[model samples]
Target: MKKLVFVFAFFLCLAISAQDNYYTMYSFVVEPQNEATVYKLVEDYYSKNKPEGIYVRLFENHFKAEDMKATHSIVFLGTQEAVGNMYAGGGNVNFDLFITKLNQYIKDGAGSAMGKHIALNGDTSTRYPFQVYLLLDVADPDKYDAEHQKFHSKHNPPGMLVNMGNVIAGQGTGHYNRWAILGYKDMKSALGGPNQLLSGPALAARQKAWDAYRASNGGVEVVGSGMRVLLGAW
Candidate 1:
């Protein structure tokens, strides 16, 4: 009875921890005339006044999607509250100047989404130069998440960051339940190919795991996957 209670408590703690780690992303296309100005302003602002507990990364979309266009910029926020505060004209240092420049230089419209981290692997501190965004339609979120976590644990690659998040609110396709961010060191590394983390026997093992996961769940469908180049980060 005591052992079972301890195991339950351990898993409960993990669930709470996961909930505490939140991410918010805003995607928008830069106006043709203001592209240079927008980039300079963002770089200058973040360099001077870095936000507390927030790791900011700016990405430019590399691949074209049916719904999304190239040159789209994605701002990744480390905290959920940061999203609300950022748009509410509060919290961020130099908010007035930042908002003013952003409004002046960028498009008026943007897409936003908030999600909590389910699983993560590799170095989270160092900023990578490129990222692969995987938008998925999950049939069984819980089971799919478990398999994803297991896969990363077994075949995690060095210098590669893999993180999965469950979308709770905001824009993009309503069918996408979860998204995964795969960070790579450089453009060359990113373009090298898929399943870079798994090799030899590990690759086989991962395939088997995926097969089992698919069999159990109705089957996972990938809505869209795109690569993005890092523009600037702080």
Candidate 2:
């Protein structure tokens, strides 16, 4: 418990920000044949046992790594404390039964990441179909936040969300503990996001802006990047 609080405080990007936006993401593998059944099991369970104040979504990974066996991930959103408490005990017996039922379809636990939402900006009414996740090694949070905010303030994307958060647990802890996500209206927008920005009308200016976004913040390292597709949400 002591370590948990400390990690949250350190990783909860921008400590001044609210803690109500913490998120927990878990990944699992499903056989191609059992994919639909797994989703149906989750949908039916969540539909019946509505956990108050929690919002859940299922994401199908557009896998980049060849060996990454995880096919889908589930994300839970709510206040940090509430989410922590909820997952800490599986919420209740019904949820436990739900998990047990769902586990039969999943091959294994792929991975997971739970942490504070350092910053979140954009529309929430619709969970975009495509999400790009950047695994980063943020050397300086203060500097990174400065340039991140400055760049976005000048040119925020339409119908897009830019989110930066810390990874309190899961893969690459202490190495790449941060992630920046770009949510797009669809796969087309996401695929063309960078090319469209840098290749169109204002190529020079856009290139300069993009360069600055990368150079600043002590040259933040992007360890990896991958996209995710929406499966089910409720």
Candidate 3:
């Protein structure tokens, strides 16, 4: 079985940010033999602290870029206000303790990105626990965004949620400025099955549009692409 190749997905920029959801992701290296311990600590922390309208997920990175310097990523999502104030004026003893404990299992921190939710298609739920993320360097933001919406609305699967965003504040962004996240029911679905994958005219049209997009704006580069398993969400 082969996963659907995450190619030519037009992950647009600020002009497409109509959704209020914002997200931040921390890329970190895990201490050897402490993966479970790290996850448990985070799970315990979120389970107790209990913030409103905030979502958190731990992702085990697979086939990630060599330069990433991380085996896992912690992603936090919420309304702009909630996310911006997630750690604001923190004075809680428990929260401070949680951080202290968490740091022990983390070997090193690589980078992080804060972005706005640009567009969303299909369903949004935990049912789709697997994801594919393509970090892209977008040139013509509006053009790609328009084409992306039109293409996915007609060709995407039932539960396939496609989320795109522009990176507002990012550490180690390198050359990429946007991200396209695709969700699936499970690893098998994410990796694909016996049936033919994305074939036929739909794929062709998308490729053609992508080629044109590249021609006009120097070129669009996929900075990196990889799969992630969702470990926890809250």
Candidate 4:
């Protein structure tokens, strides 16, 4: 099946220029018995030291590969430079402290990656309660982005915003090149399939656009997907 990957970039102003948004996502395979402890620790940590200019959200992978059981925390920063500062402990909060607390309950350390946002729609400010992530690989990034943006302009689903970003740093997962994050107002709105959200004509148009998008990009493949709920934010 051809995968549908969406896009989003960060909002930043540097030297009077807005920089492309960057993202750092940490995927953790928590020990099953320690899930509660891990969740509590994560929630508590964020509550106390909320980082600035970064949006932190957590998710449980509702659908994932059998070997990829995990919960993910995605941190959105405005610039690639910000990503470096964050990891190097230049941010307002103590990342080392956060990581120390995180290591105790995780099965493995964490799978981390960095990417740049390419496209975004709807209100990026409002916090949505649920989100779906589409990990994709595209043969041609430029063509894929053009077609996807065209599709979005004509057939966007109501109450849901789309974002796409390309992986630029972090562990290179050979299969994925970009990410599509679909934000929803609530879980109920999120569960509604695309067909249900759009009228017949709009849905058809979307499908056609997607087909063209796939063709132009030399075929897009969905390597992974996950559904997450909003956790406490700083």
Rank by TM-score, descending? 2, 3, 1, 4
lDDT for each residue of candidate 1 in 18-85, tens digit (9 for 90 to 100) = 22566566666675787778778878887877556566777778875766743656454554444334
Off by over 4 Å in 1: 1-15, 74-76, 79-93, 194-199, 216-218
Count the clashes in each prediction.
0, 0, 0, 9
Error of 1 at 173 (Å): 2.9
Error of 2 at 212 (Å): 2.9
Regions of model 2 farther than 4 Å from truth = 1-19, 88-91, 194-207
Worst 10 residues of 3 by lDDT: 1-10
Q: On a 0 to 100 scale, what is the lDDT of residue 126 in model 4?
A: 77
Q: Positional deviation of 161 in candidate 3, in angstroms?
A: 1.8
Candidate 3 Cα errors over 4 Å, as ranges: 1-19, 171-173, 193-219
In model 2, how large is the Cα lDDT of residue 159? 68
**lDDT digits (tens) for residues 1-234 of candidate 2:** 000111221234344434458877777787789889888988998887656778889888885566666788888888855665565544467766777678777877776677767677777676778889988888887788778877765555556788888766666333786789898887778978844634455556656786888887666888788888888887
**lDDT, residue 25, candidate 1:** 63
Models, CA RMSD each: 10.1, 5.2, 8.0, 6.8
lDDT scores of the candidates, listed in order: 0.67, 0.72, 0.70, 0.67
Instruction: Write one digit per residue (lDDT tens) for candidate 3, span 65-161.
Output: 7776678888878876676566463547887677778877788776667778877887665466788888888777777676666656655656567
lDDT of 3: 0.70
Error of 1 at 219 (Å): 2.3
Q: Which stretches of candidate 4 lie over 4 Å from their true place?
A: 1-17, 74-76, 88-97, 171-174, 200-218
Top of the candidates by lDDT = 2
